[model samples]
Target chain A: MTMSHAIEVHGVSKRYGDGPLVLDGIDFYARSGEFVSFVGPSGCGKSTLFNIVTGLLAPSSGRVLVNGVETTGSPSRSIGYVLQKDLLMPWRTIMRNVILGLEVHRVGRAEARRRASALFDAYHLTGHEDAYPGQLSGGMRQRAALMRTMVTDPDIILMDEAYKALDYPLKIQLESELMDTVKAAGKTVVFVTHDIEEAVTLSDRVYVLKAHPGQLVQEIEIDLGTDSHAINERRLASAFNDYYETIWRSIGAGGRTEVAA
Target chain B: MTAFQIEDAQTGAVRTRPARSRNRHPASRRRTLLVFLQVAIVVAFLAVWQWGATGGWISTFLFSSPEQIISVLAQNITTGELWTDMGVTAQEVLIGFAVGAVGGSALGLLLWYSRFVADLSAPFITAIGSIPVLAVAPMMIIWFGTGLVSKVVIVGFSCVIVSLTNAYRGAQRVDPDLLDLMRSFGSSKTQAFTKAIVPGAMSWVVAGLKLNVGFAIIGAVVGEFISSSAGVGHMIVTGSSSFAMNQVLAGVVVVMAMVLAFGLLIDLLERALFRWER
Candidate 1:
């Protein structure tokens, strides 16, 4: 059973004002309910690609389609984004933060409140509805941020290095739980990160992007036998190590050229 | 698992002892007590001043006792002169404050929305703000005559510049990430300004307004002193010219009370407006 494409980007390019191109002629696609990760070194324009796909930035060339609708320069309502920072309003309680998107979209206040309440248990943020974002631990803040994104019920979610700041043990724990939650919710996700292990551990397929004027270099599919949580498998580690070495070699050559400039 | 059990046991013991209050050390309590003691010392000093004046250690001609000032206040109150003068001063102060605040906020928003306007007026605003209100009040009275309008303008002139500068800086200093988030969410330019910029600038705007309260009162009083036939400043001027030290002291006391009351009101407004700042 094949899933339909939820988002499609074709020959997209981006350049800042009077500057060199940051993203050059990239192509990517994600199917419904698929978890895809884009991994590359810093300044590889992974975030730029995420921004372009989410309609935050207008691509210099080419087109993007979300749910078969053109989204090149058009704002998308079906997409939800989680930035690197939690960006939670310090004045708002956890419950209020989660319902912010819905309120902005003009969803009925009562209905938005009800939907947010239902997500509390699933997001592991129960008994924290009254707590302000400042009172939360880093991990808990990220969890609340995730719940905020999910409460809008967007068909596709774009996360830009959302877990980059967490400690290693906490990162692994949250990644597993996030995978479980994503699977249960049955939403398509495009996660951008620079970590090779994180890319292989959570993604159904990983797209490796090249540095400086980022372009799609390779796409590797992971067949982890129906259980994404078994990311600690020995075979998987070896395969990820090989992929990491290849990526590191590519980045090394890219870095030398940058230094020569 | 053993480490977890041990940590849990420690936490349990800590929670059992009303740890929240226990965590507040003696040093913090001493610091709080010290602050109260300092306030008491100030009150005691004021009481000594009253006692020294009444006991004739200080001459009544130079320094009227607190009791003399209180009696004068009571006499003026019974004769209805206090209320009349207070009403006049209150009107000038309030009108000036309102005009200054509204005009300043509007001009500030205009400048914030237009970079070219801000660039054009920055130096001009600085020059005008540099001039003291005392120097301006007499000139304003000469131009507008000894009337309420002159006093209100004097107060407004003193206050508007501070409010404009603070509000403009506040509007300019919004977090870039918050703006980006709003952009990503498809907020229109107007919506973004309304939701993010206005709310973000409110605290600084309130700070500027609070500072301007004292300036407004001073402007009104100075304007009255320069030319007015009425108001608290006129009473002070008359008392000073006649060498009636008690009346002068009484007028000074009334002005001080007005300034303190306005300051308290501003503090209340700050609390009410920026409860989130807590």
Candidate 2:
């Protein structure tokens, strides 16, 4: 097994023109085939950090290395980013939307269609290839978004609350599917979500974060002894609540939960 | 009939679900009645007007009864005068609409590439757009002469501003998320413009086309009114100068028909283009 990191963020800090640092000295890394998540509240600069990792926004201080080379000021195709919203082009059919990256990369039309068709079948979106995004359910749209990202075959995947918009049942189902797909591909994933249970269930390691100039609080390695690919089963593991409570406390939402209880 | 079968969430038993009733074909027999009522209103209106004119209850010379206008239309059609005028006017309106709407949208969307150019031209575009087409019509005629060129220029002028502004606004309002997605893919600026920005602004561009349909017709007719020997506008002007109400109303009827035809054409286009939206 390769122990080298696939992505590394070295003391990254971001500030907007004399404002307080949006991200304060964030040191993060993801090893090959590892699933890492940043669990935090809103305004925690998770999105800012994701953008920096994607090279869309440059950090004020420090650098990002992708595949061991510095990638600064220029976005590379080595990373695939799936955002909170599906961002599917409404004018395009599901099939067309999935092939957008290939199209931008100047892939041949026939080849792009062929590659995209395989994803539709594997993702169980076979019959919906021709349907527009508007006609699909929220879960299906999110699935298509994931398919769009995965088809590009980026070594590192960055998801920013990608499944937060789905209902509980769909979220769990997609999480399982995502886990299986990433495992089979052996791709490193960096996920950001405010859902503690989600972070606990899906991630191999979780980074707890606090708001207001977003800083990392703790890093917890999850070892539930359950199949991570089976996210629902992982939720039922004995270590689930302990990990959730620990991350929840780090986020400082423990008081509210206690009051509610 | 059963459309499909599914397991009930609570019972875990398979249940056949009936197909949804679209109600596309209503059993209520009101379609014919509605058509008859609409026809009745129009016929009643014409009958009352004709009766009033014949009985001297209204001034036939001023109002030009429907029968008199029909007679004038028939005469003009037989002489081929009305056909020539309509053809000229339609040609101008259509050509102007094609050129102006397309050209303006292209220029507006192209502005997306350079924020500096867009910001620079904002006030100038507003100033030019605010200037009434009537004020510019004479200047256009003086420069280009009272030929088809001037009329075409006038129609195009009336259309260009609205289309430019609408298309530009639409491009501006495109969801930033999509642009971010494009950037994440490392798409070139031109690719982003063509694949994302242009398609994003299409609905607004189409709306501009619809609005410009009216402006095009108005411009053509008004150009004819200013200085033209042939066109619906000329027919209306000649009839008015001679106090021939029938000819004037005939010209009006022709223009109304033109507007309706263009409106229907645009509606058909909109339907075909936006099929994916729903």
Candidate 3:
């Protein structure tokens, strides 16, 4: 783990009420400005870990520190969380929904609109300012969710399966735009997804989790060619196959973790 | 409509036959047929009624032939009695609906925010809501007298109960995820209530009003029936006493028309207010 990381999830574990443990002792960190992903099959506790890190749920054990300061089970402006569901308010217009965070923070409505207006065009949501979430297509709805997250300009962003609902081309386009935006702003991003290729393409370091009482299985550091920015181009690079194969084999081994790889 | 068809990209085989091939002319044709049948049914029913009266197969004194009812309607229209009675009933209903809507929604919000108050009042509210308004109409007349006060009170009472119930249910049904989102943003309880809860309850409020309008009209007529001089209920009661079947049927027809007009107004308001719902 990098020193003075933007997030520190030290030995986190979770079990709801008297239910079986959903996660075992798991620890990870995302350094400042680094893009990290947590990936595994269903029931691997990826979302459970995310909820703890974002302070939405308190871990049964251990604590999370944002920029080295603990904020467990409390709302914090330091983190922005985008859930798998878009969670858009159906009643509000797109502009109003996107500015919800600013409104919650007590920012003036006019000022919030000003800040949000600049992003509409860049996010490909220019003409939909007055439209409701139901009016937008599925991909556009997810993009609006992203815009809602990014507009707050939080110190750390934790996205839980943010693009899984979308189809291929739109997902790829959104992934690139989000990457470019976060990279330019130098914000720490922790993404959770089941798609290994998505993790490999977007993360600087990808941490794989084991299913049922989730634990950290492996951490792979991704190394893209020096100048590659386009995600699809990176996917086509010769080096890409090696990384995919390695991760795939590791996951297969992870299926029977007791056996030697 | 777009489902179950798979032209496999690699093998290029039609794996599953599209069920019923829904995108054909038959669907539109069927709708046209259904509409024509509806019009035909209404016309046939009206013709049968007119034939029964003119052919003397049914007693006009008891059934009040369509022509007699229509003549009564024309007489009332010419004398301006229909408008006067409608105005009186409409005034009572309007005052009642306004009072009930505002008061019930406010009380509901209070109950929503205060857990103890909600728990404390739960049994009493259910008990009160279960009682029929018509049974209490006599008591209302005795207390408020034969003027508009009694009618308005009954209408308002009916409105309050409905609005309160609907608003409360609406608040309870707010999406839990949205609540979490608000909490994650560090929104104050008040902010969450105003921004999320209120808007979420709007559909429920509209639903409550949908019921309230009909109930309020019923309450108004009942109140007027007990002791009012200038309303639809008075006309119906007065016609019944004199055994004027035509007059009674005319009053019933006028009431039906007025209720339909109010219902249309509600529909328009619902469409305008909840335009985003669709």
Candidate 4:
């Protein structure tokens, strides 16, 4: 029961106005309903890749396909992007903020409102519809942001370090919940993160990119088993050593010297 | 055994209850006290001024008593002359404000949309804004005559620059992330302007309008002082020339009332327009 590819990037390269290339001939793909993570050091062009994929920036070379449709410099309607910041409109209520994407896409007002309401319970945001973004806790704000992105019903979601702002405990909690939500929704996701454990814990496959003209160094398939709640310390420790060590070595981190082998 | 059971149930209920609300009663009381203190200060100052004038500590001719000003206001009100002059001034101010607000907003949008226009006209606009409206009033009178048109033009001239500068700054200060989000959505230039740029610029626009209300009043009054025959400013001129201190004070009071009323109206409009900001 293999899934079809939801997004495909082939030999994509991006450079800034005759400057050094940021992304160099990167090849990546996410299967339908798959969760994939891109992990690397700072300045590794992970965010650049997310931008190019979402059509915010054009790649210097190569093509991207979304749901088998060729998407070269095309407006990214088929994909939803969640930035690091919640980016909720401070002036809008929680409900209004969640419906912003649908509003932008010109979805009918009534239908957009209907879709936004359906996520309230699922996202644990019930009873706070009229509250402004300022009134929300950080976690609740992020949840509203996720609802905003998901309300568009995009087949693929592009997240650029979306949970990096949360504290460690909250980040872990959110990562697990988000993974469950993405899995249940059956949407493909391409997440960029600096944290290797986060990449491994949430992703079905992780692409390790190298810095300075970022290139895909390795792609590792994660097998975390079917039980979503099986996030035991032992499993995390082992995955950290196996995946983080390899990724670290690729980025010249003295090959796992920081953590026990 | 029954006593222990009851205590255990009570403790369980207390543990299950939600956390106490964070609302502060003392803070609200302090805010009320502060407002009361402000009103008291204003009242005390007005009382002292009135007492000094009436008690002969200050010459009545130089500084009319509050009672005298009030009586003059009442007499003028009963005769309906105050309303006529106020209505005329109000008309000029309203017309000038409308023209200035619309023209300034449109020109600001134009400059925001085109960098060339912004750079080319920056110096000229600055020069015009820097020239005092009083200095330009005589020329305006020569061009438009001692009529409503001259007063309106003067008010518009005084107001347009403030609106333009504030609006331009507002439009230019759009959040980069919001713009990126719009761009990612493939929003057309017009769509982006309507949704992101316009709403973001509204606070500044309202602020400029607030300031321009006072400027508009000044422009109209000064224009009338220089030339007009039928406004509160003209009444002030007649009163001063005749050495009627009470009449001059009455005219001043009317002008102050007009300014205060316009300022309050703008504040109400701001509240309605930017309710989300609260």
Off by more than 4 A, model 1: A1-4, A230-240, A253-261, B1-37, B40-65, B106-112, B138-146
Question: Which residue ranges in model 2 land beyond 4 Å of their true spot?
Answer: A1-4, A253-261, B1-39
Q: Tell me the tens digit of each residue's lDDT in model 2 across B72-109.
A: 99999999998999999999998888778778888888
lDDT of 1 by residue, A1-261 (tens): 644489999999999998988999999999999999998777789888988998878999989999888888766888988877998877678988888778777789899989999989987899999888888899999999888888888899999999888887777777877888788889899999887677767888888777778877778886545464644652265466665566556556555223110
Scored by lDDT, model 2 comes in at 0.89
Tens-place lDDT per residue, model 4, B139-258, is 999999999999999999999999998888898987877877776666777767777777778888888998898899999999999987889998888889988888898899899999
Q: Quick one: how many clashes does candidate 4 have?
A: 0
Alpha-carbon RMSD of each model: 6.9, 6.7, 7.1, 7.1
For each candidate, the DockQ is 0.31, 0.65, 0.54, 0.39
Tell me what TM-score chain B of candidate 1 gets against the true chain B. 0.84
Q: Ten consecutive residues with minimal summed lDDT in candidate 1 chain B?
A: B1-10
Best by DockQ: 2
Judged by DockQ cut-offs, the docking class of candidate 4 is: acceptable
Evaluated at residue B275, the lDDT of candidate 4 is 72
lDDT of each: 0.82, 0.89, 0.84, 0.83
After TM-score superposition, what is the CA distance of residue B166 in candidate 2 from its true location, in Å? 0.3
List native contact recovery per candidate, as a fraction of 1.
0.25, 0.80, 0.68, 0.45
Sort by DockQ, best first: 2, 3, 4, 1
Point out where model 4 deviates above 4 Å. Answer: A1-4, A227-240, A253-261, B1-41, B55-57, B109-111
Model 3 pairs in collision: none
lDDT of 1 by residue, B158-227 (tens): 8899988988888888787776666666677766677677777888888888888888888888888898
- For B1-278, candidate 3 gives per-residue lDDT tens digits of 23676788999876765466564677797899999999999888867887898999978778777788899888888999988998999999888888886678767866778778888998988888888888888999899888988888898887787789889889888988788888888888899999988988888888888887788888888888889899888888898888888888888887788788888888998899788878
Give per-residue lDDT, candidate 1, residue B247.
84
